[model samples]
Target: MATFLYRIGRWAFRRRRLVGGLWLGVLVLAVAAAALAPSGEEADLAMPGTESQRAFDLLDERFPQSNSQGAEARLVFRAPDGRRVTAGENRATVADVLGSLEGSDQVASATDPYTTGAVSEDGTIAYSTITYTADAVDLSESAKAALQDAASRARSAGLTVEIGGSALDAEEELGGTTEIIGVAVAAVVLILALGSLVAAGLSLLTAFVGVAIAFGLVSALAVPLGLTSTVAILALMLGLAVGIDYALFITSRYRDERARGSEPEEAAGRAVGTAGSAVVFAGATVVIALVGLGVVGIPELTKMGMGGAGAVALAVLVALTLVPALFGFFGRRVLSRTARKGMRPGGAARSRGREAELPGRDAGRAGLGARWARFVLRRPVAVLMVAGLGLGAVALPALGLELGLPGDESKSVETTQRRAYDLLSQGFGPGFNGPLTVVVDTSESGDTRATTDLVVKTVKGVDGIASVGEPVLNRTEDTAVLTAVPRTAPNSGETKDLVHAMRSALSGVSSGTGAGILVTGTTALNIDISEAMSDALIPYLSVVIGLAVLLLTVVFRSVLVPVKAALGFLLSVGAAFGVLVAVFQWGWAADLIGIEQTGPVMSLMPILIIGIVFGLAMDYEVFLLTRMREAYVHGASPGEAIVSGFRHSGRVVAAAAIIMVSVFAGFIGMNSPTIQTMGVGLAAAVAFDAFLVRMAIAPAVLALLGHRAWWLPRILNRVLPDVDIEGESLSRHDPASSAPSQTSAAEPAPVRQLPVGRD
Candidate 1:
């Protein structure tokens, strides 16, 4: 099969220039379209109810006073010495700081506290959520720049400022992941990596096409679905990875085949027969894993599942058809020998089956695959114990993982904001700002329970709160919001403590006539989000596992293939989570990853890792399985197939794994801590899958299963669907497919190796 593929790749090269031009054009158009198209996130968020906006929205309607930006910036100042805040000198300094902030360059009109009706009764902390008054009419570039400049000035003052809201964070996070219009980094990177401008150009081209097609597909699905911004990033990255990975696999194979002897037409045919089939199966596995997202059933997760699935599907098609179609057109130079046509490349081609061959195989001891299998077969128990123990040790860290967002280091908050936050905490309690909002509505709009028994009990017992405010009578006198001020920042553990306290106290609030109470805050939101994600995980995993099995079963015509694949995938998943727990959650790799106990991986990290790493893992799974199946078809026993398959596919799988690991690990250095977590998790998963799972476990299982591994009920086998994934027809040499005499036009050949024990 390998030889046949080489023949077809040679033929494609002889006709390179034309196929090259076509693929180039298609790729160029795809990228052009994606750049112009609005992002999937922009479309959903362009309207209302798209974001999981917490307290801010209800605060807008129910507590109108609490919602506006009129509170410019909190100013909390203390004397530099250990002096109490009441000193006249301290007051003077505080007043001076306030005056400076109000009079600063960016303050369009810092609210006059006495006049604006917004100020704390106490003198310890004062703040106004600065309302930037940039006009809507100033939609020009200059206006945007002006707003940016003003923001810069505000931060540069360095008053320990915090913008403290979701809108700004959302904008910032999205902006970080969002593609700006000016540069195409993927394209440029490809150009540099591929050495030849045309090959690099080809890589960029396929990826753009993948993105363009993925966008249309993702956007169409969003009409009936919902997913978080995290999902969008997942899909984009998958699309690009598959896009480049697929093209590179085939391109590399085709080049090698051309160097062997085939001309343009034969080479193209062989490339399709060999690499094209592998690409199809690889993409299928990825899509199947992504579909698991739907099983998880979180609306956003589902959206991600659907979007990623769509992107994988599109990437497969584009990689196979458009890329190959392009190759068919540009087959000439695309396959020019890495050096020159006359010279040996000094790679696998020169080293195969010579002095380089291991002595055991040549010394009447069978091959390397045989000798290794013999060794492992002799001590299966020992091998299993060693491998299992290693996996367990690596997985230990996952036990302590916690997930949450930390402060954005980029924001230049004013001293006023920092001082104010500290003052609020110090004066009130740790849960001061982390209050649980409970709105009590009364029928009379007059006298209601000013202090519900439940509220009083709850606040008194809560750990984080310094105190609860008495319900203030509104103008209606019908509705009142009892604020349970926390002793810590809203994002802190104290906030969660407050929520638990309220839950326990709800019984007290219900005493006598039931008062309407709704608990809402940052803590409540986090709890809900975490629950949703957990709820979604099982089903998502099931879906991915099931689909993967189904796809593998069809491709390999063996039930064991899917089962073995799942086992391998899970081993790697466990290993990855364990590493994350130790490093991010336990701070083991703080120096290397540059984080200090960031906590459990990001909320979305688990799901994202499951999909991407699983998909890529399956890529190797398919690649390795295909070789084994081919050998089996040619009459080799399962043992022989496993040996040759591993020996032949191991190097490629490791190379591919390294490349993917490097790319994902790149994000460990990204500006955002979240991306850093993702980088670490993904890179670790790939490495584990490649070396530990793929190299060791998969082969071990197959070795043990032997011939029974491929068994399927005859009924299922006959009725099951047939896919030309390995392009069997292309591997065969036929007179009708005759071409120029200069190159071999052979099709994928039959496999032929014996079982390990028997041989």
Candidate 2:
């Protein structure tokens, strides 16, 4: 693998113009396709095989006028303290608002509160229903503006008005100041780490190009593929992050090679051969975890996983080809002035001698990583215990984690939807915001009315039932639908229990009446989705963990190292979940992060964290450990190898982790609760995994294991294909590639054999 990559990298560097033009041409074609493709529609949020989804499909087939398929808004109006909404003047204002809403071409119908008996017992609060002709995403902006205008007029007429519904939901505004800030932070980090503005800019440039191409292709295919905006955003986020990091790794390696006296083309080849091998394996781990989302059987998640995988793959390709080609153009300019000076004439010999000195000792110039590695090596048990205890403490809160879908109740208090939700809760009850629709199909029953009555009676008798509305039958009188309000909030655990209890209670009615009965609503659908996510979590974890262990075993050619890496990943993910539950569920320091409301964590958050964090965790594990294995194979002691690996790769790994965290954290500023939760969760996962697990626990474990850390059973080693992830084969295949100038007579002899079973 390393030999092949080396050849490709050297070829690309030699023919820079052709390689650069190829990528540029691909980008242009992607842009043109995106521009010519038609706009994509939102994917259906349906959970097939669930009772709620079946009920929805049945409603659409049998009762088209039910307006269940269209978006609807509830305009809640509250009169002044001493006035009632039914007062002559207040009634006129309400009538005028309804009239204006009905006049809009987008509005299918608008009902008056008086005629619909939607007024509160005190008559001070009332709500009118406005149904739109199109779905929420299809609704025109002008229609929303008209609704807002009508509400504003009512407010001026001494009535407090607020509108709440799916029609008001707009696509989350992405690629603005938040993303720019993240990119800016990443740029600064790169510049500081590389110590060259040109190097930093080159990394960012390649990453941006990869992201643009990936996003363009996603956009072009979204319509036909049923991809959502969220998928595109996810693709952009992962692409930019991994692209920059991959390029940075290769570029940093190239500089190291040049400092050791390798020629420009040779340095590029070695860099790509060694570092690019790690990048490909790391990216494969990510892609494996992402593509494994298909096992969850959710269409949206599958699309998102595939989209993100595509972006990461593109980043890897760009790093292997474009990065080397760019290096050819920059040559020594890719390094800082001081670095370039250090590589001049006889300077490379002096630098190489200095680097080849005692592995763990660099006199007074030893780096922080070197010092930390020595400390861990001296007291591996203590370091492991401290890290373990700290991460365990952080993970304790995960035991109390609850999952649910975010609704208006989870929105900021300042949003009109939230305000309307609160007002409705105050006037009616908390359950009014989340009414469950009971759909009864009685086509097989001789007495439809009797079957419908039995369903309503059974539902009303449920423990959590607050009220059951009168059953309204279809024109054929074979199907009846009713609304059943619960006594708890939409996202509350009690409401979920209520839904389950109602289903259990209605099963008997269905059996006796020979009718189909389903409980469904926005709230019920969300509950079903949450349950589906929870059920899939175990299977998803199994698949990804198995993949992680298998992939790491092949990459490192060790049994214990893969096991240790997988366990460390679990710790990081658990800690991330704890942080999520602490802030989003327990409201611990929620205000500090701008969380206006707190409830259950988003249903999809846990699965997302596990899949994404597993990939990223493997990234640090592979990059850091491969270098350690390289040092070990090159005749360094286990302890010395740990120090040597940190000395070479620690700063780059740290920079990459920080860049990824920043990109994810930037999404915290988004107004969407789901996005905000994802941001905090992913950011926390990366931080814990990178700084604590990889830096401390991983090295400590390796130190404790000593020579046994790299052990692989002879039988399994024979079965597993040798990937040569450390580019060890490159040194053997081309003796000149291993610079003799970089080694000193005092240093230990290099081990020529494969390092699979060092013990």
Candidate 3:
């Protein structure tokens, strides 16, 4: 694969324009096709085979009229003078607002608060309901615009108007400022790391081009794949971070080769052959981890995973093909003139001679990485024990982790939905914001009123129950729904407990009265989703971790290496989760990140973060460890190999880490709570994995293991194919030869005797 990549890089460099034009064509077509693709939000939120899903399915089948599937807008009308809404002026204003909504073609129906008893007892507030012609996510922009215009006019008429619900939520604008800022921050890191404006600019350029293509593909796939609008933001996050990192890795290696006195063309091939191979393997690991999200059996998660995987695959493609072509175009100018001049003042031939004799003796250098490597080797056991203890201490907070959906209260106060939510909680109770519907089927009981009475009697006595609305029977009288309002807020643990209590209560009622009772609604659905995610966590982790371990074992040709990598990644992820619990769940400095109130971490966040961070951890692992393995294969002493690998890859890995951290952290600026959760979680995971796990613990453990780190069973080694990721393919054209070739590098480092095991 490395040789094939080298050949492609060399060919693309020789015909740079053709490759450039080809990428240009892809970009153009991607944009055009994406623009033409149908788009909105496609929500496949049904968690099949769960109790809540079953309840919902039963409701939809048995009582279509009672199903809450249509688009709805909740209109909160407030009296500015603190007068009763029933007063003449306030009443007229409320009526006028309802009339305007009713007159709009976008509204299928408008329910009056006064007539429907949807008013506050004090009469200072009243809220009507507007049912749209289609689902909120499917509503046309013109319809949403009309709704907003109506609200504006209502506000002009002396009424404090606030709209809430999925309709308005769908209409919320997701600005690109977050992506722009993230990319800008990443560019700064790239410039600082690469030390050249052109190199930095090319990294961004390659990332943008690749992300543009990925964005178009994700948008186009949204419809067929049943993806939500959130996928676009997710793609942006993954694309910018990985795209930039991929180019940085490849570009950094190309510059390193140039620094070693290879010609521009030869350096490009050698860089792609070596670092580019790592990029391929790293990207594949990410894609594998992401696509593995499908095993969780959630459609939304599956869509998210597939979208991210597609974006990463494109990033790898662009890094290998487009980046090399661009480098070819820049040639020696890719390096600043000072850098080119500072290079060893010899052509490829003399450089090969120098490189041939440079290894083994270079181990005692005083570079920071080398010094750190030496420290680890000198006291590997102490370093491992200390780092392990620290990681465990940090991970302690995660034991108390709770998972739930963020309620409307967690949303930005600036949003009308949030304002409405606050008003609803104030006027009614927190439970008013998330009413639970108890569905009772009377077909078996043959007495609708009897079943209804039983349900109300059973639920009203529950410990946390606030009130129960009268049961409303469908036209057929076979299905009845009783709305139960709890005293606790929707996202509170008490509310989830209340759901369980109610379900148990209803089950007993059904058994006694021969009626079928099922508890469901938004709150219940969230509870079920949270529980399902919790239940699936272990299985999901086992699968993803197991696959990762197997892949690493095959790639690294070692059992202990893969085992240490997996266990170390888990420690890093657990520590990241601990940070989340302390910051968001425990409310430590939450306000700084725009979280006004701490709640359980979003249910899906843990799953998504684990998948993403696992891949990212593997990325650093492969890039860093592959260098060490290369050194080991050259027969350097295990200790020398560790020092050599850290010297070569440490700076690049650090840069990539900083770049990824910046990109992920930038998403905190988004207004959406979900995005904020993702931002904090992903940033923490990457930070722990990069700075703590990869740089600290991994090296210490490897140092302690000595040659055992590379131990593989004889049979397995013979059976497993040699992956050739060490860029031996570059030797085909012998770029380091005395006579110049189109693609070659400094003469391959001479092999020394492998060190015997230390322990």
Q: What lDDT, from 0 to 1, does candidate 1 have?
A: 0.56
Model with the higher lDDT, candidate 2 or 3: 2
Report the lDDT tens digits of candidate 2 across residue range 83-174: 89999999999999888887695898988899889999888899999998888777888988899999999999989999997778777788
Top model by lDDT, which number? 2
- Alpha carbon lDDT at 516, candidate 3: 82
Clashes per candidate, residues 3 or more apart or on different chains:
71, 0, 1
Off by over 4 Å in 2: 36-38, 64-70, 345-366, 732-749, 752-759
Off by over 4 Å in 3: 42-44, 65-70, 80-82, 138-159, 171-178, 342-366, 378-382, 442-449, 512-515, 737-759
| Model 3 CA lDDT for position 456 | 93
Candidate 3, residues 1-759, lDDT tens digits: the string is: 888888777777788899999999999998998899887564636677777777788778877764555788888888777577788877777777677777576678888888998888888788888898778777878778877887787788787888887787752244457656766888887776676788888889999898899888877776777777667778878988999999999987887676555777787888888888888988998898889888877778888888888889999999998998999777655664446555454533124332321122222222667788888888887878888888889889999999988767888788898999988887788889988988888888878897798789999999998999988887888888889999989999999999999888788888888888888888888889889899988888888789778888777888888999999889988988898899878988787877777888888888899888888898899888888988887778788888877787777788899889888888887877778888888988898888878888888888878888888777777677767777765665544544433345345566644333333
Q: Quote the RMSD, in angstroms, for model 1.
A: 7.4
When 2 and 3 are scored with TM-score, the better candidate is 2
Q: Rate the local accuracy (lDDT) of all candidates.
A: 0.56, 0.86, 0.80
